[model samples]
Target: MNVIPYNYSPEAIRLGILHIGVGNFHRAHQQFYINRLLEDSDQQHWGVCGVCLLPSDKNVVENLRSQNLEYTLTVCGRHGGDEVYQIGSLRELIWGVEQPEMVIQKIAEDTIKIITLTITEGGYNINKETNEFDFEDEKIKHDLHYKDQPITVFGFLAAGLRKRRAGNCSGITILSCDNLQHNGDTAKKAFISFIQAQDKDLAEWAEAHVTFPNSMVDRITPATTAENIAKLNELSGANDKAPVHCEDFCQWVIEDHFIGGRPALERVGVAFTADVTTYENMKLSLLNASHTLLSYPAFLKGYRKVDEAMRDDDICRYIRDFMDIDISPYVPPPAGIDLEKYKQTLLERFANRSISDQVSRLCADGISKFPVYIVPNLAKMIKDRKDLTRLAFLIAAYRHYLKYQLDEQGQAYDILEPAKSVEDEQLIESDSAADFLNLSAFKSLNLKTAETFVPVYLNFVNAIKDKGISETLKLLTA
Candidate 1:
């Protein structure tokens, strides 16, 4: 039960990467890669400086700092074994709320070549309907007015890049590790827009010197609960507080477009390519969209974990059919990727018991997820005149889950969503599927008017209303 030792001295590591949003996924995926890279070579300069923006992240910063910015990463394999490694890739942890000036200074440092982000899907603040930066957002407005004391990630990035420009530090790459489509491009747009509103000169400087490389990052790092921490401590025989546990499977496809030199990430299983769109599309459509498709139905049926839902034959079949019949047609096989095997692999990943990914995690932020994961394929299916009954059922399930915040066992849960308009709530309450489809959430595709979509969606909605989610799923799979 001894923990794996670190290769390099923690004091010797240099911070070349400044990572925003020091969440579980960032620790497990990106930092894990840096740890691997550091172990193999003299890449001590590529160490990460973790940055936590929100006040809620204060505890994480304190935990990492108390541990000398070192923690155990327990990687669980599907074959029923765990590998524990003490990750020292994080050289320092910065709490942005406590020291905003230090966060800016860190970004402006010449040694910091790349800045990565794992801010959740909503962190971009793109209007779901417009797919553009929501300048009218109160946070954006506040960040613009009070640039010196910023709160959001956008403000931090803008202020940091401005400092870098003033210092004449070399250009740097902003790598987005979020799951959104064209994530790098999205970050570019959002950051540039934020800067433009604050200072036209900084925006121009960012446009010239800053590079946002889109990346497709994959890993199932669940939120670390106290139970997980206890188990990790027991397994690793260490009293680490912020240990991260994730499935052993990991993949990072990044665009090789860094302005400043990047780590030898390719040496440690990172895929650097000219284009990451195909890979991004494949993962988002098959894996992410399937997560969304299964989550609401599974949760409504009282299944709390993804693997538990995957064990149900009806739910499994529905997801398989949804992928093969509806989504696969839209997702072209990426180079060197076999679509069928990839789809099967996705099923296995979802079924990985070691990860124990929560259904609620997948269910959170559906409003943001749908546009990136579900909508584009859905739009294509409608355009191709294909049967969307299964997809329609997914939408129906999502609506039902939202309207009734109670699961099948009568346990009530809060729906974590942005403020819903009265009209949106009325639509959810309305029995008409068409009314629900007309929601601005679905306005991107005008899904309500898709001739074949409306009737099937309405039928499923009515059936779910009459029968429960479990019964409806059984009928659909049968």
Candidate 2:
């Protein structure tokens, strides 16, 4: 394997971007672009400062700091070739758990112009139904009281901005690289709302200074398992403890609304556009929604890996139908993209055996995912009175995956839904399928009152429980 070493020296680079939630996706996506930029001697000032906040990030924090903030990123090509690169752009690692003040201080520095985030959908702490910041969150309330010493993402950001305001520092753009529609606008809403609740003056300042550029990010990055790390190390001929891997396919389309100076990301494949909504809609509706459509049923059918699930004839056919028939008619093709080719590419990306993306990862956050990905098109389909069997089947499978962790083969699997609220938990536990309609994930639509959709959903729910996932999938797809 040929490992592409970054030509720039990490020590000589300056920290210009502070990225929160330094996970596999971030390592492969934004960091990958910045790694390329660092090769240009002029762009060395744009080195990344990775921030790890959650307790689960402790291992990554320790591993990265020990490795001098350098790691190998194996870009696994879908066509049986792989390219490895030594990523050295993350010059610094700060865990807010220990160095809370330091995290804030770094953000306050005018040198850090862009604060990129991969905090996941739930990480924003938005009330999905209302499309509002969750003010009642315990962390938000606590952070509001102790503003100086912050813990939550919002707390740290607000506190950092406040201190930055005091110093009359230059404006900074909070770029959200998450998979949410209108991510920058969403970030602005959540962060600004949180700031307004705490300090009106800072909120006013942020309104004028801080810019949130919406972006659409794409890449099939899986959770790096122990086996992945070991294999990557062997293939790269180096003992890299914090190795990350992803498919060769990568894209980022950003809204050109940076108040402060922005990186020359356009020089790389990163698309800087006036509006990212078209790209955002195309991705969320087709790629993300299709993932949700396939995940639960695949998981219930005893499939752990996404590539393996894609191999199943019925599963692949169902996903293609969902994308082409169910949602494609509603989604407008983005300016330069060929919708048919894009759909085919998405199918190919999902079936890439080299990456081996996990079904469990796709099944992780149904609570936050459904409202954004499936709800809009679902509502449209309901109004138009289209065939509701596919989406209805997905909801039934989702409920089963949440309520009972057992698969069709009688093997049990762990469910990861970090976004489930108290109400969601209660509804999931209810014996009646009707109660699931009240879930926050389905709050956008009155699933119970959708006369055409409800009965079909109920029938599928009954069918899934009685006949198991595989049989129900066959009948539904047939």
TM-score of each: 0.97, 0.98
Q: How many pairs collide in each candidate, listed in order? A: 0, 0
lDDT of all predictions, in order shown? 0.88, 0.92
TM-score of 1: 0.97
Per-residue alpha-carbon lDDT of candidate 1 for residues 199-245, written as tens digits (9 for 90 to 100) = 99998888889898889999989988899899889999999989999
- TM-score of candidate 2 against the unseen true structure: 0.98
Worst 10 residues of 2 by lDDT: 2-11
Model 2 CA deviation exceeding 4 Å by range: none
Q: Total clashes, candidate 1? A: 0
| Candidate 1 lDDT (Cα, 0 to 1) | 0.88
Model 2 Cα lDDT, one tens digit per residue, 320-385 = 899988999898988878999999999999999999999989998888889889998999999999
